[model samples]
Target: MASCKFLFIYPDINEFSHAYDGNNGCYYYGIAQLSSVLKRVGVETGLLHYTLRPAKEKFLNDIDNFTPDIIGFSSTTMMIADVYEWVRWIRESGRHSPLVLGGSHATLDYKRVAADGLFDVIFIGESEESIVEYCQHYRERPTNILGTVVKGDNDYIFNPARVLEQNLDRYPFPDWTLFDYESLYDMKTHKRGILMAARGCPYRCSFCSNDRYADLYRNKGKILRIKTVDYVIREAKAMKIQYPAINYFQFVEDTVGFDRIWLKEFSERWPREVGMDFYANLNVNVCNDDTIKLLALAGCRRLQIGVETGNESRRKEILKKPVLNKTIEAVVKECHKHDIDVNSLNMIGLPFESEENILETIHFNARLKPKLLQCTIFYPFPHTSLYDYCVEHKLISESNLSRTDYFRESILENPKISQEALYFFRDNFKTLIKIYRYVNIDWLIRLVGYKRAGKIIRLFRTRSELKKWLYQPRKKLLKYV
Candidate 1:
């Protein structure tokens, strides 16, 4: 038989623009890695990023051009709605290609996805090994393959779980060439390169998907695995050679500072060999003076630390993060001392959290004064501890999970606060932080609380609006001038 052709689509439900102009978007690392694995096994594969061209005309054009045997989708919870729509369109258009769904959302909610009857095969957990196996034995009948939930004649056939790859170094470097890098730039730094030095997170935050991911691979070997320092350096060197215009690299791992030994080795060799400024996400608990210093030495220009919440009691009990405010402060200060810019990732509208709790978080972050304060409304992803908590309390507003977007609004209905309050706070968090910094009336602000403070903050909302209005004209004028 001829080699089976696969077309992987990364849905573009996200509101963020991926225009082909100067403002390019980041590449999905998961699809890139899967494509690499398939290529290594001599399987022909093509990638179509819907974000690059979200129009149906372009989508159909590409589909007709490729004419693949299998059409796969790598989706998150937010992108599942778009995936369903696309699947329906494909079926209506008389495309006989089997649809496969993979990624965190599909893995966590396989039964629901399977029940929808859109996907022929749903891959749970990792798909690097499973995809190759499935393609090798591509036939009309559902073959018994591990790590896949196949739709049979009557019911679905849930296969045995697949083992996790213990040795990450064995896998080939992700096929960066698969992505149109010319139209891709890191949204954060506007850089043109992205890489994952490791896979999986060691810690289990209540709101994180890591816990469910770990449970899926319970009997399997270790969940957290890292590439060899030399392997990482080699990949970096090759990426730089391939994309000579890449200004900086970003390691999109869950936590880069988890392994001190691996970090030290990487720090020692990365600067000597790759010699490019990089950025990474770090957990506050693992960050110390030594690790911060090492990261700085390795040419890490910026570090993003998750300060999920500042309410100590709620953070410890509800969020399951045992980190103290002092530890977070120390890490931020250390990064500042080392001339590394710090970005704080925070969340609002968590379960059992009151408006006061959110104020505490705001105050804590204001005091820290990170270069960037990135905040998102809490999203209770399926299969997470937080998701269960929301379900138990009946805080979930709607059955459709795709209706929520962390950047836009909160889906949960908290009895302690109103949704309007959550939206106001999320929208104006940075403005509130700035006001708190210049004003020496913290005691007064605390006494008044977020509700009253929000009222006061609204008084200045007109000025902010006016500034935006003024800036638009100047911005447009500059484009022409």
Candidate 2:
């Protein structure tokens, strides 16, 4: 029998502009893992970054060149509309390869996606094992395969969930070579490396979809699993060899600093083996002075911590994150004490939140004084507790849900704050923080509010303009001297 060929397409309709910057920042790890698994079995696999080129032209060219027997797409909620359009075009263009859909969006909305007729098969939860099994039996009936939803003549056939891989080291390392490595650079920091040392999040924040994802594979072994420390070191060393230009590494995980034992092992070995500066996401609840010291010793230059909201009541009650504001402040201070930069992830326009709550968040962040602040408008993704809450309260309509991009605008309607007001707060949060820092008067800030406070800060714009004008000449004068 001829070996099966597979082509994985990552849709390009990105909500964030950074994805289109030809940087490997948007490389789909799911497809890369599947490619690694497929290559182990001697299957011909090709990956097409459809967003990096003309979608239709690239689609046609890849099909003509690779001649794949099966085409797979890894999609997120924001990319579903574009994926559907591309799938429709593929069918209309007279291609007959079986189309498969996977990833968070497909797994969460399997029934809707299966019934839409765009995908012949949908893999729920993890697909590494299921994909390998499906490809082995490609010539036979695949409807009975576990972890698959097959579109039958009358209806979709739902199969049992696939078991999660308990020992992550069993699988081959993700096929980073499948991507155009030169194109993958961090736009924010200008770094050129990305890796996922683990899978799954233990916490179930109401606004996030990870909890729902965890529920999908409840009995499928441990959901939160990490690669062995040795395996991680090996991959890191290999990446440095493959991309010599990569000076910094970014570990894309929910909480890279969660496991103390694993972190200790990684910290001790990473500096000796890899020796590159790195960044990671950390949960504030798990961080302390000791852990911060350990992370710094491991060559961690920056940490991204979630300070979702400053309103303790709203954060605990609505968001289900019981972390205190004081805890976050302490964590940030400790990280700074260790000479590590901190980036705080904050959100605005949450359900049942008022404008005052938003102001409290601003106050919280300003007081903490993180080196970087990322404030995104709230987006109620489907299958999340927050999404259902928005639905029950009618804060978000079905039409509003179509726009899943969190950065675009607020989709919810609160009686206390208008969408326009939310936009104003989000766009001006950093500037407001700077002003609050300069003034250092709490009662005055509360009295004037964000709008009037913004006006007050604008009075000093002349100084900012003058500084910009003097910057270039000052640099030249220093160089000559």
Top of the candidates by lDDT: 1
Reference-based TM-score of each model: 0.89, 0.89
Q: Give candidate 1 misplaced runs (Cα > 4 Å).
A: 15-24, 52-58, 140-142, 187-189, 440-481
What is the C-alpha local distance difference test score of each model? Answer: 0.81, 0.79
Residue 414, candidate 1: how far off, in angstroms?
1.3
Q: Write the per-residue lDDT of candidate 2 for residues 41-156, one digit (tens) a residue.
A: 97888877655435677667767798899988888877788778778888999998889998888887787787677888898888888999888887675787889998877888
Residue 369 lDDT in candidate 2 = 88
Model 2 clashing-pair count = 4
| lDDT at 101, model 1 | 93
Candidate 2: segments with Cα more than 4 A from true spot: 18-25, 52-58, 187-189, 438-481
